[model samples]
Target: MKKQIYIVGLILFGLLSCVQKHTKDKIESNQSRIFHYNNEPYLIKGICYHPVPKGSDQRSFETIDQDLELMVEAGINTIRVYEPIDDIDVLDKINSAGLKVIIGFGYNQNGNYDILSGSFIDYVKKYIDHPSILMWELGNEYNYHPEWFNDDITNWYKALNESAALIQEIDKKHKVTTAHGELPDALALKMTDRIDVWGLNIYRWDNPSELFEQWEKVSEKPMYLSEAGGDSYMTITKQGYEEGFNEKAQADANAKILESIFNNREVCSGVTMFSFTDGWWKAGDTDTQDIGGWAPNSSGVPYDGTPNEEFWGIVDIDRNKKETYVVIKNKYKQTLTEY
Candidate 1:
């Protein structure tokens, strides 16, 4: 009888250990380093803004506040701003508005790449404590020219790992991601391990479904669309905006691309459209060969007039929601209900 009791006790202990292990796994899987109001993954949906520097008399805090209020009402929980080197007050305003921020690092002009100077450790220590920060993006589209950094792909990975390590050491709660342009399966293998999540920028010419399928095969991590949409010009020019080939065409393409991603919720985390407004840089301007097809020249230079129809914003420069915005809102509503 004593021997039988000892066997039963061993079985009970084993079961208890299994239960504890399972509980721990569940907790870690659901943990979010960013904003967690009630231990649930905060569903972040929002837009990205071009760098709006503080004390730019043209851009006021009140303007930003109004925009944030609009976004929150539209069901957005976060906003990823361009990497601001020094703008604590603006950061505070963002936090006060109740939106999480994904801070970007690393900037390159032409082929020159530069990490934020100073002790990497000090940089992490300074901002890790900020309540609004959600994640750290090592760079935007840094993989575009790996040869520029170092001909060796391994060197790029090492750099990414180093940056990620610094951020993790200071703030383990926040996640790390890197934005990359879509390429055939052969090219993406280079930077897969360097990032926690994948940031893909898609143009109108590319099929969203096809791109998603190719990336999904090799990557199990969540993905987000860092940039999307094309020039909305009515006229088509080779050097001008090419995504949709025209305004209505661009809008229609945007709707289709977004719909495809939304339907496949299991693999996608979320998407941030290319921009909120027309900016001075004419990269999206169609008239300039240097700037390429992303921008159409409707509003003309310096963005002084009613933004041209080619400007791919849910709202025109006038700040009116377009058909694309309606489609987006409807799709968002459907997703919330279904998910």
Candidate 2:
């Protein structure tokens, strides 16, 4: 009996050693590139969302799977989410669904933050082993804060470089990108080696053609519009006003921008619409025109709780496909086939 017990202990020790070695090998191989798909260099076609925020919606595994199925059915291969720490299990589900993830970090209440905090680097070390992650987003549109302009832009670059180096140290296979909130000047910064691509959130009012040209002149790396939209209220007259923009105008702008980007394929990688549904928006949300929040009137009231003009979803909050969905689908199909 004593001999048998000793033998069992020895076997258990060996198994634990193998597990530890496997984990160690993964970390040591960080300098090596392991993230690739389809045997060809692929660009992610994705959507942006805060689907599972802490203390808000705790998305069940089933909910995550269903959402991924919808994205895949929509021909989207990438899903960008903020706060990976909040919903790691959902992230695993996203990976299992064969979707590439652009995970975000460093969100503060003021919206001006940095990866220099090193908290983001620590988080990367934990799950850098996951094969589903295609890239690390230091933060979402953090550069657009006016505070960034106060300091030397080099500071931002240095922060990005350092954070990126740390991530590479843990997993060199993934790329690092910054999500710029419509600040074309941010693209002009000297951080090309630190960043692999430019992620822009372009609103309908911006001059897409001009911005594309400007980015092309500044950076050799590829660019992607992580957020673009025709808010329901986007209109030509509201072009300059904060709240006056109309959806039709936004849609028209989207087509033109997509056409320019697709035609000038050398500079742009791909474009993703801002959202799929009209979600929660607080009163006086000035950061963006809340076009996705309103819907046409079904009752005598001029407006109902139904999605109003500002709601830019390709589908209504109820999941009914909109006219914009057809347009986007047809355009994407044409572009894919042509390319």
Candidate 2's residue-wise lDDT over 1-339, tens digit each?
999999999999999999986654222211112123334445456666543222233322334555676676677777676656445787677778877777777644233233645677666776777767777887666664537545565566666667777777767667777777664564445564766666777653423667767765665665777776555443223334234423454455556656765554445566666666544342125334343433222111111212343365565544556665565666665555122
- All candidates' lDDT scores? 0.56, 0.57
Residue-wise C-alpha lDDT for candidate 1, range 1-339, written one tens digit per residue:
999999999999999999986654232221222223234444446566652222231323445766666666555656765553345787787788887777666644232223534244454577777887777777676556667566765565567767776666667677777666553244445544546666666653524677666656766666767766544544434333453324455556566776766555555566776555544334443332122333222232111212232355555544566665666566555455122
Residue pairs that clash (backbone atoms under 3 angstroms), model 1: 232-247, 232-310, 233-310, 240-286, 284-294, 284-295, 285-295, 286-295, 299-308
lDDT score of residue 125 within candidate 2: 76
RMSD (Å) of each candidate, 1 decimal: 11.9, 17.3
- The candidate maximizing TM-score is 1
Q: How do the predictions measure up, each by TM-score?
A: 0.68, 0.67
Model 1: CA > 4 A from native:
1-39, 42-44, 51-62, 107-121, 150-154, 183-194, 204-207, 237-247, 283-310, 337-339
lDDT of 1: 0.56
Q: Per-residue error at 167 for model 1, in Å? A: 1.2
